[model samples]
Target: MVDDVADVAELGVLTASAAEWSVAVRRAEVIGRLAQEPRVRIAEADEAATQLGISRRQVYELLKRWRAGSQVASDLLPRRSTGGRGRGRLPEEVEALLLEVIRSRYLTRQRRTVSAVYEEVVRQCRTRGLAVPSRGTLERRIGRLDPVASVTARQGADAARALRSAGGEPPVVEGLLEQVQIDHTVVDLEIVDERYRRPIGRPYVTVAIDVASHCVVGLVVILEPPSALSVGLCLAHMATDKRPWLERLGVEAAWPMSGKPREIFTDNAPEFTSEALQRGCDQDGIKQSYRPPGQPHFGGIIERLIGTMMEMVHELPGTTFSNPAERGGYDSQASAVLTLAELNKWLALAVAVYHGQVHGTLKQTPAGRWEQGVAEGGRPATVSSETAFLVDFLPAERRTLTRTGFTLDHVQYYCDALKPWIARRRQLEKIVLRRDPRDISRVWALDPDGDSYLPVPYRTMSRPPISLWEQRAAVARLRELGRDQVNETALFAMVEQMRQITEDAAARTRRARREVERRSATPVTRRTPQDPAPLPPAAAQDPAEGEPVRPFEVIEQW
Candidate 1:
């Protein structure tokens, strides 16, 4: 039986025609509101029916169908099976296989003819003993594919660039989380470490910007270089609730944006193309698009936003100022003050300020544009489990599970969850393990059944949690000491010694730098893209209430 409450917040409904899908979206907008109310009222039902061009009874029927079907936009999709009189939908397995083949074979540079693709589908169905869809059906399916996606796949992104919509909005973006552009850059600022309060180096920042509203939806800053794990962490932040995150940062601001993107566009960097990222997006139902090689303009939205952000960084205490010419021999290392956490807090406040300022093209704030979108299409769905979503994107490692447990980088992991697999270890092949590069205290193991992941912690729970970079640094330190074969104990001992040395050094310098305090005393205002708004007193908007304020600036006209 077909599920009435399917809630499939997937990509576009490709099976329906564009005109039909348009009508469905309009209905979703109207019906989505009534579905949320605890009880439908007489006046409300009549108004909704009038807006939808349907009878009051039909409005009730539509609401019931939406509640039972894919609870998102797909719930209101046009279908032939509503009355159970027309040709019902294909079997789930058959439908999935057909879509998969069409996407992989037909929608490619090869540009196979519909007839050829249909024949291939027919052969696959015969092998699998499933019914073959007709050639007419295949052609219509191809016709219903998003034009931007079709051109990008069959021709190239450069060809698709000509088809993009203008007006400062993301090309062809009509809804939130429809397409997000994520990119990474080395921030042009030297940052200090939390331990010794000394300059560590410049850090990398990965940012995700929503195309529809030009909102900065996700951000990540770390001393480590950008990698697949950095992209994963940024994604995890993008989809989950940000309230708790903001509260922890002690930033009192409204950043209500959070949802999984239906399609994400990024540059063709190794981190963006890694198997871990590709498989993770596939697992989470995210479609990936890359800008064509040599076409820098394809990534203009994200790149431009990042460049604007760097202008704000220019006002900071330890700013490198973009280049040696801009720096003019200023000692960024000696003047560095803000640690990674403090810098992140400053960024949060800055983004909040940016969101409130009006966008020149849209003539409204980014947050206002976002709320306007919600008023029409409804709020996007947020991820239910942060851990589950993040596990899909974490860097993967394959290890053979012994009777005891799995080992990686000389560290062992075991849990009661592995007891069942221990007996079958000999028959089992190498199992996939995923560990967060940020924290290496535990790893998530893909179960033999391949459906769920099991959390495995260190065999000896007493070991302290450390980052992957710290672990490598410790190992390098031991090697420098002429210890050829290092054990787990020796590796941890070196790490502890290193931590003690940094702590003792930190004890020597307890006073704040005079230059850091002076520059940080005055707060700079973030200007809007269209019209520059006057700076509000920083103390009034400060999340810390009354404290030294970090400056924020961006010539939004850029």
Candidate 2:
């Protein structure tokens, strides 16, 4: 029985302390059963004995003591002698010595182990002519120290601070889409440009996941890093129907989930903390909750979802995998075959697969779980329109309205709506310019009444619809070509010409390198009639020796 008890303790099924609690609860229940049936105490004692697997007399004695007005549970539970650790075994002076040594030497960034501290404690005991406690006693003392202090000693202040809130289990979100998490991670696969096929770089993917259903509601794959624009675009994708977008990519599946989430949980990224995002949330009646700073585990839901998607990406041809060891000798850049557009389509398909496949945690496909949630009366919230979402969530900047029209980043913008404000500066007035980071060809100027935005087009029609990245690249290229200022027509025209030139060059190179085989061609092993006779080594003099030496006469100079 003693060995069995030790084994149980080792297996963590039951401990000495836990067993004592179990006995105390049983004692209380048995006592309560007897008290209600005083006349049938003997019969009750028999039943209780059988149920508890103890002798009947023991139950009787327990009831007798309970009837005598003692705390039955407390008296039954195990207690140390004199309510303390084996009293008088280790001197108080010696315990204090050990604690002081641990606090001063062990509980620090130096990471002094308990064994080292114990050895030092022995030395201190000898110096003080004190009795040395056993090693177990010293270890127990160390274990009893405050957990925060212990972590601080072993790790550092940051880890110790994190430990404060890391102790509890994650909060339970009750309903599907009741809370959603959003985060961004750079996809670990290299991609190339669609036209030039030159290696661009790894693209960032911002994903929003339903916390309850574990469904990936929306994602944006772009060459840009995490930014407010990406966050807003991700939210727009979440709140709007995705079927059209998926269909554009030739993805044949159903993405029936889309709605404005009630609450959004995010980390302390600047994009999440940006003023535009906060204002949009407030305007849309969505509550935004930021995870505590320095505690990334709080946003584990979205992070894990991103990780899951990246794992799927790893199966592709040019994946970077997760680490150098996993990648080994794989040439990610040279092996890259997918362009950004192709990658986006693949991501859409992967998301479809993710939704269809059963999740280990949800025990159901995310799509199935989402359908179930909707069937059980879970309705998704939605925005007015995609245009409204973009206008509301896009970042805003301040610029002064001028007669030449509002210029931003060295580009001028004008529209019929801006005619009234031209050369007329309202008192203390600055036009609020809202530009979409994805598209810089246009911007919206807020009306003075703040009722609507006035669309402002680029000053030149030659500047076709282009993204911020393209615009920047064009400007950089012009600068490289020694241009001090950008001529809108000339700059954009040059960009288009360069793109055309590259495409034509690639086409020509491919065409010129094409191999052609003629049906009449044959090997000369049998000396075909059309084949010329091989020249002798001496007769085939090097071309540089001018073997056929034409006669020439030197002209006399006057």
Candidate 3:
């Protein structure tokens, strides 16, 4: 027979539950209407009992209760049987004592099993002159307590609250560029070096995701690890239109997402706390917020997007699969086929795919969400200009303007525009020089009088473009080679010398490993060299107390 209680529940009736008694009363009503008489016949009652899966006596009893005229079906149904053997025999005091221990000692403290609580109760009963209930009886009592209440008492508020369906307020982002999340993750693929085309390990990819639309506004894949410079470049990327960038990558899609975000959400990474980033945001009127410490899930949107992007990366060669188990002995470095530049281009195309693909949470493509946000009066925040944004975001250093121009980390930069300030005793003011950490060939100098920046390039036009990383590496190489006084000419020369040798050595090593070399094993020798003739006993003796200690001192005073 179908359970009316469960059926009513499945129908989603929000009122009181349909108990077994109410279900029986419903069957009785059907029986009464079928009988169409003052009193129900035994065969009629038996038929109803068969249909309802009840006894004839129960059918007649339900009919009698129904005729008594109760408005509710449950009231007309038979009451449940009770008072079986040993039931309700627990003394009131014993019951009270057990409940108190369970509530105060077990539930309210560290979680304890019912058996443990029962044993404690039994022990307490032995201390006093009271009898203890059986373990089965105690288990029934424990089961009757509200599960949620018990969990709250035994565990913690956070744990108990997590069990519920509801939670804290959802993020309130309503438009594109309203709230943006930025994070850095190392791309799970080995990329070759730009020059040598040899695997140079993985690169870090910094991404900025729009919170409302789930669109990637900006991304930067850098050879260097995550740092303040990477963060600055990422923000610069976010503020610029991506059409030219896409074209550079040879992609045909239209990526119209760009602009200064009104607010950027980031974690408490040291790069996010950098002065240049903070100043740029302040100058551009962008609000910056850091996630609270230890709670990484607050930035789950960007993390998930990074994971999705990596899924594309995993499809390529040289991919370090998500985990060691998934990789299954794949050699990412050995199989590397994409150079950093190629990876950059591939990422640009892959991101376009992401923008067009449907998002599970938003139920639409990110581009579609962006369009909807635009239709609802959401627009991109404006910046002065792309070039200006880059200048603002670049790391700054203080240098004195002299006849030779500014010298940053021993690299000389000169421009004809600085001639007026050259060799002139100006007021005590230091010029602010901003340089891209990736490329140090040129720097932007703030012109105090005009309040604009002037580009200063290396005086020697023949010098190759040197990055900050390369410059530092060259300095370290020179130091290792016993050259302390470094000049720009010597620095570049050393960097070129080291680069060729390092690349050649790596290539040779790779080739050598591939060629199998076989050699015959030689017989081993166990004999140890005899101990050197014990140093002469007379010569080894210590100098006499208060006597000059060495032969040189004893020989003569210079």
What's the TM-score of each model vs. the native? Answer: 0.60, 0.66, 0.63
Q: In candidate 3, residue 296 scores what lDDT?
A: 68
Q: What does candidate 3 score on TM? A: 0.63
Number of the predicted model whose TM-score against the real structure is largest: 2
Q: Which digits, one per residue and each the tens of the lDDT, describe model 3 over residues 466-503?
A: 56766897899888889889888889998677556655
Per residue, candidate 2 scores C-alpha lDDT tens digits across 1-558 of 333222222221122344566776787787766767747556777888888778888777776666764544644543346665443345556656765676677777888777888889889999999998888877765555556657766797677776565424667876777899999988899876555565556778899999989988878887667998888888888877687778777888778778777899999889999988987777667799998777777787787888888888998877899999999999997888787778888888888888999998889899999989887855575443455465667788889988777888767887655656664666538877877765566676777754456557677644665555556767888889998978776667765765556455553442211110000011111111211121111111122343432211111000
List candidate 3 segments past 4 Å from native.
Answer: 1-167, 193-198, 378-385, 419-426, 449-451, 459-461, 509-558
User: Which runs of model 1 end up more than 4 angstroms from their true locations?
Assistant: 1-171, 477-484, 501-558
The candidate maximizing lDDT is: 1
lDDT of 1 by residue, 358-469 (tens): 9886799999999999898877767645556777888899999997798888788887768778988989999988887756777778878755676677787778866676
TM-score, candidate number 1: 0.60
**Cα-based lDDT for every prediction:** 0.75, 0.68, 0.68
- The lDDT-based order of candidates, best leading, equals 1, 3, 2
Regarding lDDT, does 1 or 2 come out ahead?
1
